[model samples]
Target: DDIAEAVISLEIMRDRATAHREDFETLYAAMHGLYSWFLRVCDADGKEYALKQHEQLFETWGATLSGEQSLSPLESAGLTQESVGDVMRALSAASKYNQELKEQKERMSGAALNTCEKVLNPLKFLLSNGATTARDYRVVIEKTLSDTEKALSTQAQRSSLARLPMDELVKIQFRCLNPALAFRELVGENGARSVILTSGTLAPLNSFASELGVDFPIRMEAQHCVDMNTQVWGSIVASGPSKRVLNAGFKSRSDWAFQDELGASLKEWAKVVPHGMLMFFPSFSLMEAIVHRWR
Candidate 1:
């Protein structure tokens, strides 16, 4: 009965999305459907429904891929496959994306509401880009993100957008679990046949390699796209008017005099810059206070 409800909810959402023909509406419907589906799947005995669905779809695709059998594709199923081969490919992508969605849900449990966007962004990309036949899957990704955002908004203490970066966007993270050990387990107990880690910021290769438990890893530096010496600029302002050290370190964070000085410095900087600028405060309370003072 719950499974039936979930299916019905998704169908209704799909209809609404089609009617609206807007990404936001489509995404909302998809997210709502996923939330319903998640509730049902999580309630199922042994929580095996979602896993079984992916596996069964995978087997169907595998048989088609191997030319063992042929099945008629139907637009109703969103299969619309050109042939048994196309159907199989579509099914394979759907299966993979579905699996990813499941993983994302599990990982996001108990996480801050604001963190949902970052967590769901990768799954969204996988469905929208790599999973061509997964129109339904793509919808689910959008829906999940929508649901997550809504959930996070209810939390009064969650970090605001200015402070957070979606993992899929910036491809950087801090103060979170390292994905290295998980990657090691995924490729193999030992590791993949060949593992390549390349990033411009991945300098001090030894430090990174050691953290990932890689032994004697080969390293190479790619050619720079521009001259760093000519392009890069920096500044240091270490002292205040009285030659007293000016710092916003944790020890001096709550000092009102320090904050006032910092604000004055920022105001001076703003006057020099013509267009616009951004200021990052350590905490929301501090930002609110600064803004109030400025006003």
Candidate 2:
């Protein structure tokens, strides 16, 4: 019953996605469907489902490039048989890696990492021009499958438990939370002799540089091109039209009275602000909440 419901939901999403002409939307629907199906099957069979999925993906892509198959877009885009073969090899390595993790209790081996890196050229070619053709979609699907295997490899490597729970494994999100580390990786040794960062938004330069783990021997702040007195008009309003405190802090921003007062203030401003008015909110959810309250 759960699998049937998931299939129905995926069909509905695919229908809606196809209604639009955008390829990314269709791709999103397909990925969502795959994930939904995986969740259900994983719940039923745990680790075996993941291993089987990897093996199936490897076999499917391998078959596509086998024999005298018509490779239209791939050949037209200058992707040689050898480049596509790299992606196939990566998929095979990924399947092997998953099997090893599941059975032999092995982490991501150096050989597996090198094999995964070998597909970078093919993946880049497929992703260079926005995914439009069926060939692009096929390569992308294989790339995503390979990436998921790599993510699972990482999870298995970092985890201390003998086996990671299926639920937790399914929910794993790979993200770079440390900006400093990312910056260091971006500016590797000998990559950049000197990095000059300049942006109007970088007001607190010290904090920004510290966050990036970089040091600038020479730092200069350029003045605004336009005279502030003549061109820009800025004001801080502590209270709204009703003299209600315009506190947009976490707790008070949602207060009915505060929202009402802010709306009233904007209404008055709209009458005199002339051509247009731009309102900025700290976050989209907060803006949505305020708009809902106003309506």
Candidate 3:
């Protein structure tokens, strides 16, 4: 019986691992299922009654019922038919633990909801010319563990779970753009031509905006903004490349003969060398015109 409940609990958690909104629901259902099971096989008469109740419950719920519930430690013990005193103790302990878990879950949920309001509502409430009010909106995370900590001055960290049909993704969204920036997939240099780097702190943006520079550059153009919060940076480069290449995801034609002839003609004007040979036709139309003339 204990083993059966363990199996059921694992299956339930596995099913629910993808969602946060239904986390507690999963927990309750799992405990309820297991708890009901304990009464099912409690005795022949009680077991039959429990089984009937379970059948009715399953029928009513059908596939709508979650299968991702977990059994608490005490509930786990209660599932096993050990000593009567031991079983009682386990059930009592499990109930107490569940209550504490409920309280903590509620706390985090409320905190997270409030954080959402603070971040999103202001965007809607645009800064009017009206006066502003000061309220205690910041978080106050009170930890009672051995690790000492200071008062929280900002929002708390939060993780959200997205639920798909059979999968779940854990996501963390930044509430404020603080400290560092999160960049996406970087573009690679297909062929080198020119490269320029600049930053607000750069002594001379035109000279060379390296991490640290002692290199050669006769000219420079850069100045820092006195404002402690203002900063800007960028890069630029020039190159003369003339190369004909076919790369992955190129939605071109299947006419290999036409491609080969076009490549040969391009090699005639600009050397279709390994890497450094890029045509700088004014635009796509100009290139197409040239291609038409060549063909």
Candidate 4:
């Protein structure tokens, strides 16, 4: 009965994957058609206005493909499911490529702009391909993505996008990091008698167990080496003399006013701090925006 259900699920996944590929191809064609139109039109105010509109629409299409734009809760609920993690990952990846396209559009001119294109190209085979199961496929894809991002970042020409060859391009799909199946897959379906997962601060045993997909894994929180309050130096500066609230969100990231305020706060904070101060952001894009402001 379990095997039969699994088979049915795989069939459903296969159908969905095919549909997604077709949807991507259609979007690519529409965007390409606009580009072609832009090329043929003689210099005119109407043509310029139409081209700008086409660029905006193309960006929207990319956002839709990447899942940065929202869908109904019912539609996106499967985003957490291990079975469809790869699908979500692939869709999420559209955002990265979309951002890349937006950044490069202004730079492409003449022969560069005329380069032949592959719309919604799927060079990497989907896990639905019979070679690998979803369980391990997520891990493999995540590792590969990490390596690819690292290589791209370290390249001398920082602004250039990492262009993968045709063979590896298909592999650039997203993979869910917290798939919640590591324990079961590692221990085997029969279950292991003894397995230990330990950390210095493993509080909230039930949540940890849920994340690991293990039933009631034992938890132990070690005593702190030093008082956290004594060791940590934290300060909150809500506003500077300008009396502007210092906060950051997707909408606020690009606003010069917000970036200026945030940048000023960080610069002041850095001046007082004697040691290294680590900062984190909700996304790489936001982090890059702030960093650019600092530069």
Best prediction by lDDT: 2
Off by over 4 Å in 3: 1-251, 271-276, 279-295
Clashing pairs in 1: 30-143, 31-143, 31-144
lDDT of 4 by residue, 112-134 (tens): 11221221122122223222323
Our tally of clashes for model 1 stands at 3
Give candidate 1 regions above 4 Å deviation: 1-200, 215-220, 240-244, 273-295
Flag clash pairs in model 4. Answer: 123-170, 124-170
lDDT of 1: 0.39
Per-residue lDDT value at 70 in model 2: 21
- Which of candidates 1 and 3 is the stronger one according to TM-score? 1
TM-score of 4: 0.38
Q: How many backbone clashes does candidate 2 have?
A: 0
For residues 1-295, could you state the per-residue lDDT of candidate 2 as single tens digits? 2222322332333344322223222323333343443343335343322322343223221112211122343344334444444444433544454445544423333443343343233333333333322232331111122223223343334433213243233321122233664466457785677787778888678888887777777999888788979989878999988798999885577678888999999999899988979999999998998899899
Prediction-by-prediction clash tally: 3, 0, 16, 2
159-231 per-residue lDDT for model 3 (tens digits): 1111111121111111212111111101123433443544455564434323122233544554444544554
Query: Candidate 3 at 18: error in angstroms?
Result: 16
Worst lDDT run of 10 residues, candidate 2, spans: 61-70
lDDT values, one for every candidate: 0.39, 0.47, 0.31, 0.39
- What is candidate 1's lDDT per residue for 1-295, written digit by digit as tens? 2222323333333344322223323333333443443333233231322222223112111101111110111122232233223323332443343345455532222222223233333333222222232321211111011112212132222322122212111111112133443454445667578877678887677777766656645768776787879975668988655455667674465566676777677767787877887767788986786567556
